[model samples]
Target chain A: MAEDHKMTYADPWMLPETKGFWEALNDGKLVIRTCNDCGRGHHFPRAMCPHCYSSNLEWKESDGTGTIYSFTAQQVKGGGKYVYAYVEIADRVRAITNIVDCDPDALQIGQKVKAAFRPSASGQNILVFTPA
Target chain B: MTAHDARLVGAYELPYRHAPDKSLAQMQAEAALGAVADAGLSLKDVDGFFCGGDTPGMGPMSLIEYLNITPRYVDSTETGGNSYVSHVARAARAIDAGLCDVALITLAGKPRTPAKGSRPMTDSNKPDQDFELTYHPTVPANYALAAQRHMYEYGTTSEQLAWIKVAASHHAQHNPHALLKDVVTVEDVVNSPMVASPLHRFDCCVITDGGGALILAKSEIAKRLNRPSVKILGTGEAVKHQGAGDIDLTWTAGKWAAEKAWKMSGCTPDQIQYASIYDSFTITVLLEIEDLGFCKPGHGGGFVAEGNLISGKGKLPFNTDGGGLCSNHPGNRGGMTKVIEAVRQLRGEAHPAVQVPDCALALAHGTGGSLGTRHGASTLILARED
Candidate 1:
């Protein structure tokens, strides 16, 4: 992705727990924690399985494709527009991301989308979504 | 053994709308004193304390030292806007267990005043901060996602959502303390500037500075307080997720909480005369009404559109104090206001213009956190003693 095309904002690359996820994004992969015990996947990576409370977890790469569970077009004061949405990934897990490369108003619920890495204001790669 | 055996003997709201001059502790003190007096008790009689707010920093200790009272039991459960209603259930449980006799639950904040550094209080270091904040989703935007999905799945319309604000404004016309007194039409709500898709500016809640307090006493102490006591029939609390994308957006924890409350209270949904639902957003009220069994899934939009939530015209009156949409929000969880209004309705003390006639049973429901990503729901049933 070109630097100019990237959305500028504070990135969470500094968080020790999520450093690996950010590193994966930089390597062109979208990853989440899949609990080994429960055999389920989750987002915003956690130390323990939220569903089963099992510390048995591993990092797994997602196919980076999902459906827009829901979304909103935020019209900024300076005439800028951004589409924010919750993308439902595997096993009903949802990830909050920005929808890019399309008109904000054109975004729809249940629309198919895939992840795209873009440079953040903090000079780190962050994951955003685009129409698949 | 049940909430029915306990009573909320006192209720008070600190000055609503604007209180820029007062510190958080000062507002809480005023509300706490007012509630203590309303219950015909003194500070010395308060044996338990429960409070939740972002301001004042130190949790129970700040209020405890500021108010200069020590209690044996303290609960500082800070679950978004549903904290106060959640406290009611916890307080009742403590009192019933004989761990504490007289308990005070309070909430206060000054979100409108920059001098107090209170701006829609939120923790900066929460686990979900990394992902959720990166998209720059405002509170309305988060909730708008749920609203959009509801429209797509259930064919709910923006006009239907507008009615929730319209009805709240209609009730606000009669509330002297309500911040927005001007009656608003459905057209006004829909025509308002869009904050996010599927939700207009009017569809969101107001930001203000205020505080509220409630005093709960054992039935014996409540009976001798020389004031009308509203019995806490039953209460329920639940959390579905901390951040979004796990659970079904169309359903809420209210489905489980309200059912638990009804079973414990021995009161059916049809028997509820009034409802004090948390109105952080118009869609919130709609989803809660459905989850609480007032109507079936996918029927909330039409149910609210039929004017069922209006003060007098509808069978189930809601947000009789103008609700958070038009009333005071104060940056705290809204459950306190809901409880206060339910008490007033059951006591026949609500403004005559908005009071439900012969209201015997009332339901106070609250939702906390982002409705799209994560949320908590609390339900409390209150009734008058015959």
Candidate 2:
């Protein structure tokens, strides 16, 4: 894994609005932004609902359960083999995350997965998925 | 006839794959001179200017100030690789509105050896960087995510996707300046190293230094000039995103752009003698081919298999100049080269080996930004008027 020489933050820079989500992740709890109006959910949490544009959004705790919507393990030239995937979390929120604790080649679509916090190469707690 | 119509009277592509000594401005000027002269016009004749973010100094003025001519109109729309193709539609609309007489659009890039600090891995201030950057959204990986979903939804196979690269290699053999001139087969592609799961190394486009220019003149100027008339029949551009989380990874926004183009030109896919679909990746062509209405949805894989896109062999010939997959795609923003090749095919100036015979109507398309994330797509339908 190569690092961009210019990155200022080894860990995520949390904004006031996103503080709750980041704090929850570090606390060994997972959460998603749920819309009160539409009863739908989204990831990369935002203040307003992406589906209905309603400001009545709340952070609901998730059990880290989801299905593998799609995935690709990229092998860069002279670089590490990385497994990136889209996990369709419960409540219809699709999350793009890395898969861990398993062989990269063994991943498949429609498989069950559960989110877990693991240390990345940069020595920061990161979200990843494993075969449930 | 309305005085607003425009004709592409000049087209020029620089003959270089790696020009480390030349700066972006130098390449732009060289290609600009070649295009303007090819149109039987001079720099003084250019009254409108257009460029993309690749322009170095200051917006479109990097070239505008360098050439020392103040155009009556200017447009600096940036859509990554698709910017140049979108500029074609913008220039035509500007000319139709009597905004300018000669619209000159130029593109030049040197991604093979970028200037230090010019290529940043991540924008520190981009709003979503904190969320999406962690997943390692490398260019091919982002697209591979889409390929995976397409395979799941439509059953698109790697072999079917390999045909696109096969088509580009088939045409690249005819191009003297193409970077990868050797022809490749489906077996060769699938057997190559896998850069991303489902997308082998052959599935990606080559990165090379390149620059190309196009001069669209008022119809009257085109008539007086000695160049063949390449009419701008119709053009359309659109941006597609995740649609508020209701995203379908298999589809692209190109469908909307193509609809607008087809409605404006009154030309269906069957009437198009030559097609220049952008080739950022193999799956890109499959999606665009289906989106452009050349085949039914989910049928592009079968439509392109079995040498169906080769010049003399297939009913629909595409990328006779090798496209981005084999030839030059300046700065990796390939939209400019798409239109350049379409003009070549329309003018009968393509290489003798791959030239489409009596190419009367041609379509050139481009997709830029990231296909997985938010991106832009453009479509242009051109004609060689009798």
lDDT of each: 0.85, 0.85
**Which regions in candidate 1 have their CA more than 4 angstroms from the true location?**
A1-6, A35-38, A48-58, B115-125, B242-245
Question: Which ranges in model 2 have alpha carbons more than 4 Å from their true place?
Answer: A1-9, A90-92, A120-124, B1-4
For A25-129, candidate 2 gives per-residue lDDT tens digits of 788778888889988888777878888899998889888888888888878566657677878876556777777665677777889998888754455566777
TM-score, candidate 2, is: 0.95
Residue pairs whose backbone atoms clash in candidate 2: none
Q: DockQ for the candidate 1 complex?
A: 0.63
Q: Per-residue lDDT for B1-386 in model 1, tens only?
A: 35556689999987567887787788888889999998899989999999875537677998889889999999888778898999999999989889899999988877778453334533556787878887788888988988988999999999999889999998988888888988888899999988788899999988888878999999999978888998888888998773424757787888889988988888889999999999999999999999999999999998999677898898789989898988868664678899999999999999898999999999999999888777888999899876
lDDT of 2 by residue, B1-386 (tens): 22128888888899998988998888998889999988999999999999999888778876898888899999999988889999988998888889999989998889887876665767766657777787767888888988998898888999999999999999999899999999999999999899878899899999999899999988888899998978887888999975544557787878989998988888899999999998888988899999999999899899999999999999889999999999988888889889989999999999999999889999999998877777899999999867
Give TM-scores of chain A for all candidates: 0.89, 0.82
TM (B chain), model 1: 0.96
Candidate 1: residue pairs that collide: B81-B333, B243-B373, B244-B373
- Candidate 1 CAPRI assessment class: medium
Q: How many residue pairs in model 2 have overlapping backbones?
A: 0
